[model samples]
Target chain A: MEGKIRQILKDHGRLSIDTTKLAVDSDLYQAGMTSHASVNVMLALEGVFDIEFPDRMLKRSVFESISAIQTAISELKTN
Target chain B: MTTEFSSKILYDDLVKFGHIIPVGVPGIFGRGAVFEEILNRFDAAVSRLAASDHATKVHFPPCINRQVLQKSMYIDSFPQLSGTVFSFTGNDAAHRELSSRLKDDKPWGDLQTMTDCCLTPAACYPVYPTFTGTLPPNGALVDVQNWVFRHEPSEEPTRMQAFRVHEYVRLGTTDVVVAWRDLWLQRGLKILLSLGLPVKAELASDPFFGRGGRMLAANQREQKLKFEVVCPVISSEKPTALCSFNYHQDKFGTIFNIKTSTGETADTACLGFGLERIVMALLKTHGMDPDSWPKPVREVLWA
Candidate 1:
C-alpha cells in the first residue's frame, strides 16, 4: 500500500522532491505539492484504492503526508 | 502563453504613464491620476447603459462584520483567499513589549488580535444580509461600488490584493433575474467593445473548495450560471476575466430570507466589473499612452 501510494504521488502529485527519496512520513506540502495537485492526488487515490474521501477528509491537513493519507484510506475502508 | 507583454514591462509602463503607483507590496498599488480618470470614465459609461434601470446605489468599505462572513459561507468555500483584520488589543506592558520588539526589528504582528471584521471578500456580500422578508412586485435592484479584498498576491498587475468592484445585483424570480443577467452580459460586452477592447464572454465558475465544490462548479457551468468577459491583459492566449455575470438561482435569497411579493424564494443575479482590471486591460491593449488611442475610443472615454 505504501509503495502504491508513492507511485500514485509520482503520477499525480506535483512534488518538488524525487519520488524515490520521498519517505511515507515526509510532508507533501513541504515538498511543494499545491492544493490543486493535492486534489488530483486524492482523485487518483480514489481510483487506485476504490475509496472515496469523505468531505471532512478533503482538507489540506489530511493530505499533508503519505502516511496520513494511507491511514485515512485504511480507516475509510474499515468503516 | 505567448505574449510580448511581461509583468516588468507592464509595471514600468504603468508607472511611466502615471496609471499606478506601486507600494512596497506585491499586489497592493495606488491608482494615479490617469487610472482614476479611466475608472471614473468607465463608471460613467456603465451609468449611461444602466440609466433606464434604476438601481439603488450604495457604497461599502473594505471591511465587513465577521458574522456577515459566517452567514455568507465564505469561510467554508474560499478560506484560503479570505483576509481578516487584526488589531493591537494589549495592556501597557504588552505595548511596551511590542515597542521593544519593534526597536529590536523583530516581528510584532503576532501581538495583535483578530478584530470583529474581516476584509470584504466580495462587494455584494454585505448586501445580502441587509435584505429580509418579501420584495416588491418587480423585485429589487441595488447598485454597489465597494472596495473588496482577497489574499491573492500575484505578479500580474491586473490581479490586485485590494481593489474596487462596481456591481449591480438583481433580486426577482428565476426567469427575471437570469434574463436580466444574460442581457447585461451582452450589454457589458458592447460597453467594453465600444472602448476598443477585444472582449469575449465565456462560461466560468468560482474557485470553490474541496471535492463537493468541484461538483458544484461543474453544475454551475452546466447550467450556465456564470459568465465572464475576458480580455487579453497579460497574455493573448490566456485572457483574464475582467468582468463577470452570475445567476444564483435562489442561493442568496434563501440565505437572506428574501422572497418575492407572493412569498416564494427570490432568485438573485449580479453583474460585476473589476474597476482596476478594466484600466489594466485598456492600457495593455491600447499601449501605455491613452492620448494615442483611436479617436472614437478617446472620445468615449474623455467625453
Candidate 2:
C-alpha cells in the first residue's frame, strides 16, 4: 500500500516534494493541487487497494496528503 | 457476449465525443452507456477549470416550486415551455390502467400533477427559489451542474429527453454578474479547446416558450446578449450548442427576490455548457483515441 501511494506521488510529479511542509488538516485544495489530480490519486489508490472510496469520502479533504490517504487506505482495509 | 468495452451503437456514437455515462442514473433522464466516457472526460475538464476557490461547485435540480416561479410570473414569461409536476386525484390509478393499455404503446397515468410543479428546462430556477433569496457577502458565484429536461422529442442525442448541464453562475451586483460570466466564458473556451473540440461562439437569446418566443429568440440573436458555443454536431447550420453565456440582468434576481448587500435587486449571468454536445464535438474532433490526442491537450486534461 505504501509503495502504491509512493507511486501515486511519483506519477503526479509530487513525489520529490517534502511532505513535512504540509499540515494534516490544511486543505490540499488550497495547497495548489488540482481536483483532477486528486481524482487520479483516488483512482490509483482504489486500484492498489481494490476498494471503492465511499461517496461521502470523495471530498477534496480525503486526499490532503500522503498521511491522510494512508489513513483512509487503512480504514478501508480494516472494514 | 458482453464486449470487453461494452460497446453499443448509442455508446459508440457518444464516445466519438468523450462522454461517460454516470452510474446509478435512470434513463429518460440520461441513464445510458453512451454518456459514460463522455461524462468522465467532462468531469475531468470541470475539475480542472472549475477548481478555483471562487467557483462554488453546486448541483441544482430541475423541479422548481410552482409557487416560487408563479410569484415572479415566470409562468407568464413562457407558459408553453414551463413544466410543472402536480398531483391529481385518481391520476395514478388511471395512469396504471393506461400503462396496461401501453402493452400496445398507449399513454398512462394522470398527467395533471405534471402540470403543477414543472421540471425546469434550464438549471437555475430551483436555486432562485430555495438558496438565493439573498446574494453572497462578496456577491455569490457558483458552479452548478444539473441534469436538465426538455419535452422536445427527437432521435438525435442532442435533443434527448434529458441531458447534463455544467454551469458557472453568479448572482450579485451588476458588475459581479458580468465579471463572473466573463471569467467563465474565458474558462469555458479554454476547457473546450483543451479537449481539442472545435467550436464557434455566437450571441444567443432566451429560448422563449411560444410564438412570442420566436420574437424573443430573434431579438436575442440580434442583441447578442447571450453567446452560444456551438459545434458541428447536428449540422453546421444547426450546430449543437455546447455552451451558453447569458446575461440575465436582474431577471431572476427580481423574480426570486435575490438581493445584493445593499438590498437592491441584483442581476445574474450564467455560463452553461451542454455536456453531451461537448462530447459530440470531441468525438467529431479527436476520433475515438484519447491516447493519441495532441500532447498539450492530453497533458492538461489527462494528467
Candidate 3:
C-alpha cells in the first residue's frame, strides 16, 4: 500500500513532489510541503488508495505523510 | 497608505528564514530587495495569541475554484479588487506556446483561470469555504495566513501587487462572530498603541467590483463592510492600515451555505493583520533599529 501511494506522489509533474524516504504521521507543513503541492498529493491519494477527499480535508494536516494518507483513506472507507 | 512598525523586527526573523524570494514583475515598482527587507520585519513580529483565538502555523495559499468564485459573486462585486490565476492551455500547439514564451507573442491563454481557485481579495476567503454547508458544533476557530493579492496599481512602497496577511476567523452564530470581532478589535488597538504606532479606527469598504461596485462601495460606506486600523506608515497623516476588523453578517455564509448545527445560517467576522503594513507601521513609529522598539514588543520578538 505504501508502495502504491509513493508512486502516485511522484506521478504528477505539475507540482514538484518528493517520494523518497517518506516520513509518516508528521505535519506536512513542518516538513516544508506547500499547500498547493498538498492538493496535488490529495489527488494522487484518490488514485492510489481508491479514496476521494472531502474538500475540508484538503489541508496540510491530512496529507502529512504516506501513513496518514493511508489512515485517512481507511477512515473514509468505513464511513 | 504605509506601515507603522519598525523594519528591523521583520529582518531578523522570517526574511532570514531563507526561502522568501524578491521576484519582480512589470508595474510592480515597489518590490525590490529594499521593500522585501521592510516586509520581513512585519511578517516576523506576528503574535500568535493576541491576533485571535486561533492560529495555523502553516500558510494557506488562495487557490479556489472558478465556479466557487462566481457563486460568491466576487466577479460582479469587487471587479476592481479581483485577480484570476492564469496559465497557457493550447497544449496541441505546444511549440507555438513555447515560441510565445521565447519571442513574446500573443499567448492564447489569459486570466489566471476564469478566476483563481479563490479570488483572494482578502486574507480570510479560504476559511469561509472550508466550513461551507455546515457549521461547527462548538464553533471552530481558524487562524489563517496568506500572501494576499490585490489589484492596486500603486507604485508606493506600502502598496504592492501582493502582501502577507494574517487572519483569525470565527464561524458560528451572529453573537460569536460579533464577540470575537469586538474582542480582537480591542486587542488590535492595544498592540499597535503599545508599539507607539498612531492608529485610528474608521468605517471602511472593500474596493467593490465594477461600475455597480461604486454603488456597493457607497452602500458599504453606509453599512461599513470594513473597518481599517490606520497608522502612519508612509507619513504621519497618511496612515497605513495595520489591521482590519470585518463583520460580513452572513453574506459569506449565506453564499457559501455556512450554517450551524441548528441548521441556522451563520454569521462571520475576521480579525486581520496586514503583515507588511504592520512592519511599515513599526518602521514609521520606532525607526529601523531593533534596539529602539519598546521593551515589551522587542522582548516578545527576541523571545
Candidate 4:
C-alpha cells in the first residue's frame, strides 16, 4: 500500500524531489507540490484506492504527507 | 459596439489609445487618462444605484493588516497567491553588502523581512475585521473600493495582478442578503449590457485550493452561493468573469462576531466589479476608437 501510494505521488504529486527518497512523514507541499498538483494527486489516490474522500477530509493537511494520506485512506476503509 | 477583434488587438488598442500603459511586469500596468475616465464613470454608475439606498461608502488601500488576513483565512485557501509585504531591515554592514551585491546584479531581496501587513486579496476582506461587535436594527450596507492583489501572473491583459474592485456588501439576514445578491445579479447584467458588452450571469466558484477546494466549489455552486457576470473578451469559447456575486452564509459574521437584529449570525452577500476587466470588455466590444463607438453606448458611459 505504501509503495503504491508513493508511486501515485510520483505520478501526480508534481514534487521537485524524488518521492522514494522522502520519508512517508515528509511534507508534500514543502517539497514543492502545488495546490493544483495536490488536487491531481487526490484524484489519483481515489482511483487507486477505489474510495472517495469525504468533503471533510478534503483539506491541505490531509494531503500533507504520505503518512497523512495513508491515515485518511485507512479511515475511509474503516468506514 | 459590434467589433470582432481578438484579445491581442484589444490589448494593443488599450496601449495605443493610452488607456493602459504596460510596464515590464506581466500582470501589473499603469492606467492612463481614458482608463481613469471609464473607471470614474463606472464608479458613478455604482453611486447612482446606491443614491437612495444610503450605503456607507468606504475606501481602502492595496494592503491589509496581516492579522485581518489571517483571521479571514485567506492564507489557508490561497497561500500561493497571497503577497505579504516585506521591508529591508538590515544593519549597516548588511546594507553595504546589499549595495555591493546590487552592483553585481545579485539577489538582494532575501535580506528583506516580512512586515505586519500584506496586500489585500479582496475588496470586502478589510470590512469584516471592522465589524467586531455589531447588530444594528436593519443591518449594514457598505460600499467599498479597494486595490486588490493576486499572484497569478499571465500574459493575458484581462488577468491583472494589481487591480481595483468596487463592491457593495450587505450584511443582514440570509433572506435579505440572498435576495439582494439576486437583485444585483440582474442589475449587473443590465448595466454591462448598457455599456454594450455581451454579458451573462452564470453560476461560478472561487478558485479554492487543493482537492478540498473542488468540493467546496461544488458545494458553493450547488447552494447557488456564487455567480459571475462573464464576457467574451479574452476567449469567445470561455468568457471571462467581469463581476461576481457571492453569498457567504454567516461565514464572515461568525468569524467577525457580527450578529443580526435577532441575535443570529448575520449572513453576508457582496457584488464586486472588476473595474479593469469591465473596461477591457468595453474596449473589446466597441473597437479601439472610443469615438467610433455606438452613439447610445458612448452616451451611457460618457454622459
Using lDDT, rank the candidates from best to worst: 4, 1, 2, 3
Residue-by-residue lDDT tens digits, candidate 1, B140-162: 99999888988889877887889
**How does each model score on lDDT?**
0.85, 0.64, 0.64, 0.85
Tens digits of per-residue lDDT for model 2, B136-235? 6677767677777766655555665577787766778888778777777787777776666667676776666543344345545544569887766556
- Model 2 chain B scores worst on lDDT over the 10 consecutive residues at B1-10
The best candidate in terms of DockQ: 4
| DockQ of every predicted complex | 0.04, 0.01, 0.01, 0.11
User: Which run of 10 residues does model 1 chain B get worst, by summed lDDT?
Assistant: B1-10
Q: Which stretches in model 1 have alpha-carbon errors above 4 Å?
A: A1-50, A53-79, B1-3, B210-212
Candidate 3: segments with Cα more than 4 A from true spot: A1-79, B1-46, B51-59, B91-94, B97-119, B294-297
Task: Give the poorly placed runs of model 4, Cα more than 4 Å off.
Answer: A1-79, B1-5
What lDDT does candidate 3 reach at residue B237?
A: 58
Which sections of candidate 2 miss by over 4 Å?
A1-79, B1-35, B69-82, B86-88, B91-116, B131-133
TM-score of 4: 0.79
The residue pairs in collision within model 1 are: none
Model 3 agreement with the true structure over B25-94: per-residue lDDT tens digits: 5224333354465455445555544444444444566665666667767665656667777664445567
Better of 2 and 4 by lDDT: 4
